[model samples]
Target: MLWLKERGIASVAESVLNSEELDKTVAHLLVAARNDGYAQGYAECSHHVVNALKVDWDTSKSATHGVNTEVALAAAKMQFNNLQLPVMDLIDVALHSEDHVAQLKEIFPDRQEDEDEDLA
Candidate 1:
């Protein structure tokens, strides 16, 4: 945000950043903690909820009390991780996107391969 502001490209930055797609989920036991004003890593859930609702992370809070995707993605990126921000504006681009997984691979190429293939 600061960097974009400096370059007078904040609008483009604003347009580029989407929070709903940023959250990572937590374990089941952590739900009560967040409800009482505390929540563990809700990345997967948050991402699911946000992605399901198709809302921006910043504004997502307006409709939900879940984790912030934009912040999550920022932290992930600061640690040298790559988060596939929507090229235009679509969460499907992140999940069903062929580019997203590739981007994530740049960081942890060996994180985990698709195990779903075996399930079917």
Candidate 2:
């Protein structure tokens, strides 16, 4: 956000970065993806929620009654790590996505042949 403002891209950044609708849509989509057996989709959504709660813990200055940041973050991370899977169908779908593979390629162009085979 600061980078965007520095670059004079505030309008563009605001339009793209607005999180209210994204949050609602993502929450809905997480369940949908889990039901549909899209592993990464579900995991990504679940991670988002976990991370958000952690952030809330860290940032809630007035919420003295709430759990402290360290404990909250630790719990959130543990829960994220231990979340039960949806169904096998969703797990199968979530484990593989061409888009994700492509992203991996972009990030690690010299990635191994075995990596390609696994994604294939």
Candidate 3:
């Protein structure tokens, strides 16, 4: 996301980017929010929380192709069901899915980035 990217955390591999890093990134945003500075940013509290879930890398591997997005999306769907979002809320699910994919894309923009960043 443009907003999250601005935080300089956008470069971190989304896979293996656990909730800790995400939470730290969010903590900074929360401070900005309390100061009313994050209002102009793209991510809101709910979006950040959902993004955190959608981007979870709780497994033992790094970015895997269709796997990450698919699983994350399916999980988000189940979460939406629990949240009781209406059928018209398809957009929300799709948006979160996009967020998941974007996170993946940001993960491996180039294969060499890992070795370069010492993430491998």
Candidate 4:
């Protein structure tokens, strides 16, 4: 993704998005979210969470579509415990959404405004 590429997290984001295992994807995102500093990692992982689940990785969509609810719930809990603030909202929307990509867009918002400001 453009955003991930911009942040130098595109490789990990690609891996996270490409992975078929829900638990593994969530685990990878958590590690990235924790390890790469809050803002950068969270942005990258969260964006890919939406993209991965929305795209569902493979043709059938079953791979990501049927992600274990327990894993998602646990991931949400851990994120809230660890990050706090607006990230909790982002996590909640992502885990609960019927359409994760759209929900994430609404909740997390794009950095376009910030990017524009930077250019200015």
Candidate 5:
């Protein structure tokens, strides 16, 4: 009887430890996902800003001898500010994207694979 009780306690302890490890893994994955989403959003916004600046500079050069540094800086700053909302929206969409789901599955495949096997 004592051996059985000790075995039961050991089993419960192992289960709790496994649960904690799983929780930690999930937390790490969520942080990674958020970082990746934010990076994608910022990269997209930066690309747009760069393309716009290129076009603006090209037009300005054709119209004038040279671009004004102060005006260019101000315009770029204003455009960046205008894009804040779109950047946030992109980040939100990225977080909920199929790519994000695939990323999570890629990072943690063993459990899902096992479940798939069980179902089959």
Candidate 6:
């Protein structure tokens, strides 16, 4: 409708209007919207958390302290434990799937190389 077009939702309105199963179409749209929102929120939160952690680490007196494996491991463990349930769940899901692991490696090839270097 003209109102939908004015509101910038004309395509969505048209899709719903053209759908044979309006309820299902609406449900699908809702799910897609929710997934998009979750992804966006997750990305924003990740960026914020990473930036905060980086700032804290950079400004900390401990930044000058040479690497201590025990301290680093403890800090990593604490950070992992502090993560939200949703984030932990997503991580678990990804780690449990070979395809997901492969996808992650593909997406973050540098990270994988860093991990390999760490092991070496």
lDDT-superior candidate, 2 or 6? 6
**Model number with the top TM-score:** 5
Off by over 4 Å in 4: 1-86, 113-120
Candidate 6 ranges beyond 4 A from true positions:
1-20, 55-120
**Candidate 6 lDDT, 23-58, residue by residue in tens:** 444555555555555555655565687787775323
lDDT of 2 by residue, 40-74 (tens): 44445656877877653232353332333444444
Q: What does the lDDT come to for candidate 2?
A: 0.44
lDDT of 3 by residue, 2-96 (tens): 53454324434333244354445445545534434333232344457567788643322423322334344445445434443232244235347
**Candidate RMSDs in order:** 21.0, 20.8, 24.0, 21.4, 18.5, 25.5
lDDT of 5 by residue, 14-71 (tens): 5445565445555555555555555555555656877977743223233223334345
TM-score for each of the candidates: 0.19, 0.22, 0.17, 0.24, 0.31, 0.30
Instruction: Please give the RMSD of candidate 1 to the true structure.
Output: 21.0
**TM-score order of candidates, top first:** 5, 6, 4, 2, 1, 3
Cα-based lDDT for every prediction: 0.43, 0.44, 0.43, 0.51, 0.47, 0.47
Q: Which 10-residue window of candidate 2 scores lowest in summed lDDT?
A: 56-65
Top candidate by lDDT: 4
What lDDT is reached at residue 46 by model 4? 58
Error of 6 at 9 (Å): 24
TM-score (C-alpha, index-matched) for candidate 1: 0.19
